[model samples]
Each structure stands twice: as C-alpha cells, then as structure tokens.
Target: MAGSAHGDIPLTTISFSQRPNGTVATVTVSNPRKLNSLNTTVLDAFLSCVPPLAQRSDLRCVIVTGGLCSVGQQAFIGGADISEMKDFSNAEAGRTFINKLHLACKALRNLPVPVIARVNGHALGGGLVVMASADLRIATSDARFGMPEVQRGVPSTIEAAMLPAQIGAARARRLLLLGDTISAQEAESWGLVDKVVQADQLDEAVEEWVDRLLKNGPRALRIQKKLFAMWEQVPLREAIEAGVWEFGTPFEAEGFEAEGRRMMNEFQMQNRQRKSRL
Candidate 1:
C-alpha cells in the first residue's frame, strides 16, 4: 500500500490486474527484496486488497503470484518477516500478528471464484498455508514447500491445520515436525500441489487452468465453489442436500437461468449440426 517516507521506493505492494475482458484477474505480491515475506505491512496489504477483487461480479478466476527476484529466487512467500517478528516482546503482539495472518488466508479462501495459486517459488511456513488456501496450486518445478516455524521456536498452527487434509497426516507431520522443505515434485506426489512445471512454463500452465475454467458455466462455477466450501465444513448428508438445493439454483429466481438456457441451446444446436454432418 504505502511506501517509504522518502518515496524513493515502495516498501511493499499487493498489486491487482485484470484481463481486458474483466473475467480473469491476478494479484501479485511484490516484496522481492524480502522474497515477498509477510510483514505487518504486507499482511495489511492482503487484508485490504482481496475484498475488492472478491466483490468483482465479472471475475471468473483469480491467480495469485509471488513476484520474481533479480537473483532468480522463486520465493512465493518465504514466511512471515522473521526479522520483524524477532522483536516481539509481548504475547498480545504475537497473537495480533497471527490473527492478521489467518485473516489474510481466510480472505483468499472466501472468494466465490476459484483462486489459482501460481506459486513460482518458495511456499514455506505461512506461505505454504496461503498457497493451500487457494482452490488449486500450480508451482514451478523448483518451488520449495515446508513449515519451518518449528525451526524458529514456534509450532506451526492456524491454517497449518489444513496440511493434514491436503497432504495426509504422515506427510504433514514430516513437514511440521522435521522442518524440512520438500521439492515441488514431492509436493505434487503428496497431493499438496496440483501441478508443477519449469519456471519458463509457469505462465503457460496457469493460463491453461484459467482457459479451462473460462469454458465452464460462470454461475455454475461460483455455485460449485460455494458448495465446495460447504462440503468441507458439513457432514456428507448435509452437503448432499446443499448440492440438491443448488442443482435447481440456476433455473430459479436469479438471471443465472438465462445463462444456463442460452448455453444449453447452443450445445444442442452444435450437437444437431454434428449429427447432420455425420
């Protein structure tokens, strides 16, 4: 948000960009000097920034990225600013810091549209959880992942709780207890990441996901994401009922039904044309 007092350079920035069509957006965290680490300022930027993106009615997908460094380090988010936290003198301050971190992650998770984490670098500690908060993650082959807070004299908590469900308990334990970073390949095998590619191919991989998402029904995609969040929190029976209710949602009160009708008619006409050609 705000830069240094002298205005020579920005201290940290969470910048947002949208496609010309306004259906896709990118949120880039730029603190390259710190490998995009989350300081209070950076965390505050996330808190203030995500809501505006989430509220966009035209947005079908959001891609989150970590800015690249001059030295070619792919640090998505190295962690909370350890240098900034080393001076914490009170329990209240520690709690406040952690609360900010949790809120930032929750903001990403709360987006109605899919959040694709285009992780090009290290997603360690808090960064890993932020990456997890995304609906899907596409990391570079050299990306690193772990929870090294244990090494810094603190247990990994908060959204670190999500690791077990994402990567299974054994793998999650290996990360938290051992404080060792895993390669992107290992992370993909463990189900922590959806896909991994070379640094040069990272943008292509992300665009592929975005293009695929754009082909689907926009309203259905949003409803599906909402149901996904519901399914994660509720019992199987309730989740099923929620889906049942949503099954007829597009055809119900809102103008979403018009989209459904239009697409169905287009598909049927295309199918008829194909049959006649045969």
Candidate 2:
C-alpha cells in the first residue's frame, strides 16, 4: 500500500478457517495495517500452524492468502515488516529472522496436499517467496508481485532462492536487482504464478482448482507431493528412479498400502465402466 512497511492497524496474525466439512482449509495472514506484511508474530503463527496441516487426514487442500483490503484489493502479504527489521542491530538478529521466515515457507513446501496461493494484492519480497512456495498460485488481476528487498538494502535470501526455479533466473534477477513490482498478468506469463483472474473471480478460480484436486486419491496426492519436493533436490535420473521406488511403497509400506489397494480397485472399476455404456 505504501513504499515502506511501517503502518499499524490490526495486530499481525495468521488464522486458519476450515470450510465445507473440513476438507479445505483457508489460512489467512492478516496484518491489514501493514498491508499484511510478514513479521515475527504472523510468520511464527504460520510456522506453528501450517506444518500440522500435513497430518490432517480430512484436509484435501490449503489456500494460503492475505485477505482483501476494504476496497477489495488483494493485500495478500506485503513482504517483511521494515520497522522490525530496521531495528535489528546485529548479524545474529538477521539470521534469526531469516531462519523463521525460511522455516515458515518450508512448512508450506512440505505440506502433504496441494497448496494454492490465493494472491489477492501485494506479494512483494518475502511475500513473493511465500506465494512461490505454493504448488499453484491464483492471483487477482490487480495483484502486485515482486522482490523489493534490494531497494530496502537487504538481499532476498532463504525461500527467495526458489525464485529462479519459479520464474526464470533472468526474470528473478530483474525483480531482485531492479526492485520492481510486476502485474498479475506479467507474473502469470513469466511463470511466477499459475493463474490470474479478476478480483471478483479470485475465489471461484481457487475453488475450481480445489475441487479438481479433491477428486484425486488422497494417498496418491500425499505421496506425489512428497516426491515432487524430493525431485527438486536430486539428480534427474535419481529423481526418476526415486519415483519408481516410491510407488512400490504403496504395495507394502506403512499405512499407505491399504489405501493404495483401494485406489487400484476403484481404477479397475472405472476402467471396466469405460468399456461399457455409462
């Protein structure tokens, strides 16, 4: 909303609301006073709350968003709180800040189900990385996305490292080096986000994705999510082999074996139905 993240309105916090029988969760980070900027309070809340969703058997999808402002702009998350960071006196304080921010995003990345970033407004600096951590991103047409940490005299670190993969290295460099914000359309075209819709259509677009994801087998989604994260850190050949190895687990590992069998039976039934008239 402004050039600096120093304003204050409501208390910084993160809240999770489960919708429609607990299968979908919407985690909203509210710091409207600062345009939903990330600070210790909200980031700590995120780190504490998000990782536990991985254990939710009833949870099918998570929509991470910073709710829209009064004027209906997506104030999704405005980045780190400059006032807090400006007061940090030493390297240790900075490292501590980075660690918390990194862990919060790591929690998002490690989620068992798909994470959809419901980008409503300003996702800049740390906010951009938080959006990048999601499996999919649905942004409002007026959403603003970028990395402006350089302009603030700080290097974008931690999850910012994922930007080159999210958007290209050159594009990520453009934002980081120039401290510029890109429009939602540009972000989608550059691969920084997945979908862009008008503000009025944001929730509908997100729900469409959520519904599609909910149709998949839960065990398959969880296994696939774990594998996707692994693929990012391993060699290409190794990643492929790991997928093969991972599928074998469903044949006899832990609690997934039974669910895998059930899915197989369903698949067989569907195949048979396809051979006949519905």
Candidate 3:
C-alpha cells in the first residue's frame, strides 16, 4: 500500500497485503521514544491512511497495533503525547487537539470491514479510547488498559465516551474516575477486549479472527457491520426492526442471493453424501 505518513511524521505506517484472497491492512504506531503516543501528527497520519483503506472494496479487515518493541517493553500507545497537551492553554486549543484524535477514531469506526485492535501493551487514556473504537480487540495477557485522562486533569472525551457501551457504565466510570489501569484479563471480563492470549500468541489470535471474517461473504459482513453501527444509534425496537430488514437484504440483492443459494446447496450436498456413506 502507499505510505501513510504525511509531512515529517515517519512514525506511523500502513502496510497492506493479500490474505485469504482479500486485502488486510495494518496500521502501526511506532513512536518508541514516547511509547507510541498519539500525537497530533500521528493522529493526522492515521486519519489520512484509514479513509483510503476503508474505501477499498477488496479490503477485508484492518489491524491497528503498535510497531515492534523490545521484548519486555510496554506500550501499544502510552497515551496522547503529553508534550502536545501541555500547551493547550485555552478551550479552543484543547478542542482542536482532541478533535484531531476524534477524527482518527471516527475514520477507523467508519471502515466498511471490521477493524481489529491488536493490543500488545499499554493502552492508556487516548490509547484506551482508540482501542475501544475498534469493532473487535485481541490483546496480550500483559497488556494494560485505562482511561487516565482524568489523572492528567482532562476528562476522557470523544470515543472515550464509547466505554459505557463497551464495558458498561459502572466499569467505565470506575476507570474514568479512578484513572487506574486494569490487566488484560480484567479488560476481557469487563468486555473491553474480545480475547486475551499470551504475548507470543497475539498475532495468531488476530489471524484467527481475520480468517473467520474472511470465511464469510464479503457483502454480508459489510452489511452486518453497518447494521451493528446502526444498532448503536437506534432504540431497541427500531434496531430489531432494522436488523430484520437487513437480514432479508441479501435475498433482495441478486448477487448475494445467488451466492447464498450456491453455498446452501453445497452444504446440503455434503450432508447428504455423509449420511449415505454412513
């Protein structure tokens, strides 16, 4: 894929490759000196990178993670770059800074395919908010998560507000109020992360999810993801009605109908052959 960085920000990178006959794009955050902090530059790079990837019809999934670090290092993203925040002397400056981060997060969430967060280490404050924006997250056992923005004298905002829908209001409140980090296990239990694996298995877990997603019909997956986003915005009854309408959409679309029938026939044929053999 074309490079993601714009201007002098060389820390962020987007690598694209074919996997299971579909495109898989990875966005790596690589500011090791600052523990992969999400500075305005990096967030700007992310915003530029993700939209093009999202628009690709062949793209199946996007994986966001920190670039490789030393064996025992800790940080997917330590947080927003404090140095950048220190100069936020006015409400407008603070809004501008946070808005940049929000745009990055929004770009990720708007991707047509699933976005998977591969959380290898620390994901604190804005880092944690970024992780929450992903459609799914798989983290290493040693990974840490928290919303410590409050500790830094700023309440978590934008995608950080997504925590209530992710891990529940009570748990989200605890993290936002206390600014305490939680282990990967606790994060999984609280529904912040979908799975936790050994550090060595982090890539394997991500690959497994990617493979699972790839196995489904692309159009169906896209529609499902869109419906998921819609559910978040609508009331329960309206959401259910929308979902039912979505369920019948494939049949209304000729290509999806043909593919679904073909798959069903293959499945029935396999079952019949097995029964006859028995």
TM-score of each: 0.91, 0.87, 0.92
Error of 2 at 82 (Å): 0.9
lDDT of 1 by residue, 203-274 (tens): 899998888888888888999999999988999999999999998777764553466776777799999999
Candidate 1 versus truth, CA RMSD in Å, comes to 2.5
- Rank candidates, lDDT, best first: 3, 1, 2
Of 1 and 2, the candidate ranking higher by TM-score: 1
Model 2: per-residue Cα lDDT over 1-278, one tens digit each: 11222444433333445555357877777777677888888777677678887887888888888854544355888889898999999999999998998998888898888999999888988888889899999989888888888888889899888888877899988988998888989998998888899888988998888878877777778899989898889999999998988887666755525767767788999999999976
Number of the candidate with higher lDDT, 1 or 2: 1
Per-residue error at 247 for model 2, in Å?
1.8
Pairs that clash in candidate 2: 74-120, 74-121
Whole-model lDDT values for every prediction: 0.83, 0.81, 0.84
Name the runs in model 2 displaced over 4 angstroms: 1-22, 70-73, 253-257, 271-275
Clashing pairs in 3: none
Q: How many clashing pairs does model 2 include?
A: 2
What local lDDT score does residue 141 receive in model 2, on the 0 to 100 scale?
89
Model 2 lDDT on a 0 to 1 scale: 0.81
Task: Give the C-alpha miss distance for residue 99 in model 3, angstroms.
Answer: 0.8
Better of 1 and 3 by lDDT: 3
